[model samples]
Target: MITIKVPCSSANIGPGFDVVGLSLSIWLTLQVNIVTTTTTTDTTPPPHTLNCNITYEGEGASHVPLAADANLITRTALYVLKCHGQRTFPRTTHVHIVNPIPLGRGLGSSGAAVVAGVLLANSVSKLGLSKDRMMDYCLMIERHPDNVMAAMMGGFVGSYLRELDPADMERKEIPLAEVLPEPAGGINTGLRPPEPPLGIGHYIKFGWAKEVKAVAIIPDFEVSTATAREVLPEVYSKKDMACLSPITGTSGIFNLQRLAVLTTALTRSPPDAELIFQAMQDKVHQPYRKHLIPGLPEILASVTPQSHPGLLGICLSGAGPTILALATHNFEHIAEMIMARFKQEGITCRYELLEPAYEGAQVIES
Candidate 1:
């Protein structure tokens, strides 16, 4: 039996888009066992038989597939086993899942599942695979590393999808290909790699400033990642790329200034309160996504540097609906302000104060 505990995460982080993510304290737990159901007590055949039973406890418990074949954890575990050269997929396996992290809510529940599967595979097989290797498989599964990177490594992570040498790969991002399965001739036959080299490199580039608190201004309504993605235009216009004129002596480029301040907030040790608010502004996804979240404009309008003291920045978390904010103090006030605005506009929502999870997924039992 093996148990995996993976922290939930938030991706995008304003201008970082798919490149940045931060892990929160919330978690998803998974327990997997290789055993047979009581109905088939016979130790009959040479073939190892396994029965699968899955249970969910929170969040998407009622909706996530209970059947092993349809479950994300089960499928991912099977794939990892196959990649590790398992002659046959497990026919009798038991899975018990507890998901506190909300699903399809820009809270990284999928990333948690991916990390859970890979880590479960590593533990059950006693394959001393490193976290870096696990992240590789997770990246292959997601095609992006923002959520998985934070879930796997924790802290404030920044990543890029590109090629790099082994050493550089290790430093720039978690190496997914750390352990490759090879057959008789030593030529690897299993684990079909991604068609394109979607190698992602990431690390904890910075930390939050001031006595920071991450607040999730989550709404009652849900927004599917697919819908949010579909709403975005496929291309950008010249105006979108246009930077501020050189005339202002560096004042013209809006997002660049924001990115700089955001980076400073992260890189600097004690986070700079001066930079937090500006850092949270975005030019990429929010403009197009505002329509999906009810009362977003009102919520933004309600809070400002003058109106809400200590409030850093507030913006979309990953896609839509949930608006994550940063603040040095007055958490309850911020929450109340956001909640009041939503209520007045007739938008139902909830808020959660989150802290950065400094560590990634771990094995609680083996």
Candidate 2:
């Protein structure tokens, strides 16, 4: 049997929404084995027949459909095998899955499933699929390459979609070309353990700064990707863009030179109090998205960088609800302060500090 473990991910940090993503240490494991017989009693139709069995564990276990053909991971794995010229199955492949990533929480649970499928097929079939090729198929399946890139690459990945050449397709005559990223970005990331207690009335914050503690704040709420996309406006005015000048720069030329420097410092070196505070400025996207998340701006305003002594920058995880903060080594003190600040704002939320996962997905024999 081939066993693979895939990490969970978070996408879209402030201005880089749908573009930036980070893979976390959290993981889901899949075990697949080839079953040569359909019946244990030796009453099978033929010697070359195949049968399959599936088992699931952890989060989403109750929700995952039992139909193997309809299961996303199973279907994708089967598809990968077929694409590699294995049109027929002589033996059934039994699959067992263990998952922990939260679904539909902007945590990239679906991305993990897609990644596992691709990896499982390649390993079981001995296809020798390169990481790039696997990522290509996964990106195609995800409909968003950012999350997949982070999942595959296992760090902070920044990616943006660009139009593909229609002429290339015209020459080959293919329809529905894929959406992909020109490049990707990421850094080793993590979440604080002692897994924070889940309850209402907790404090939450989001955005950038020096010396930041990334508390991955999540709520007991479900928000669909479609719903979140629908809430975004189609256009913004010149005046509206003008409002971001101070945060962007004095000239507001759209060059967040200081902000980029801050990000570079944190990734190049280990995240510290100075780096977190330095990275805490967002002149873009946050204003536009504030309407979607009401408590965000208030949280940002409430957490004074140096005044808090240990807090640095704060930013949202993927979509809505999950907030991450960058902080100093003295996170406990700042965490308490953060709770107090959010309470005063009348915004109750929960948080967990996360670390970056340096390794991507992997499969091991059992």
Which candidate comes out best when scored by TM-score?
1
Model 1, 130-193: lDDT tens digits are 8876676776667678888988888888777667666655454323343232222212333453
CA lDDT scores, all candidates in order: 0.71, 0.59
Q: List model 2 lDDT by residue over 183-225, tens digit each.
A: 1111001111011111101111122223333566555454566
Q: What does each candidate score in C-alpha RMSD?
A: 6.0, 11.0
Candidate 1: segments with Cα more than 4 A from true spot: 33-50, 87-92, 164-200, 245-253, 267-270
Residue 133 in candidate 2, Cα distance off native in Å: 0.9
Any idea how many clashes model 1 has? 12
Model 2 spans with C-alpha error above 4 angstroms: 36-52, 87-90, 160-213, 239-259, 268-280, 283-285, 288-294, 332-351
> How well does each candidate superpose onto the true structure, as a TM-score?
0.83, 0.74
Q: Residue 78: error of model 2 in Å?
A: 2.9
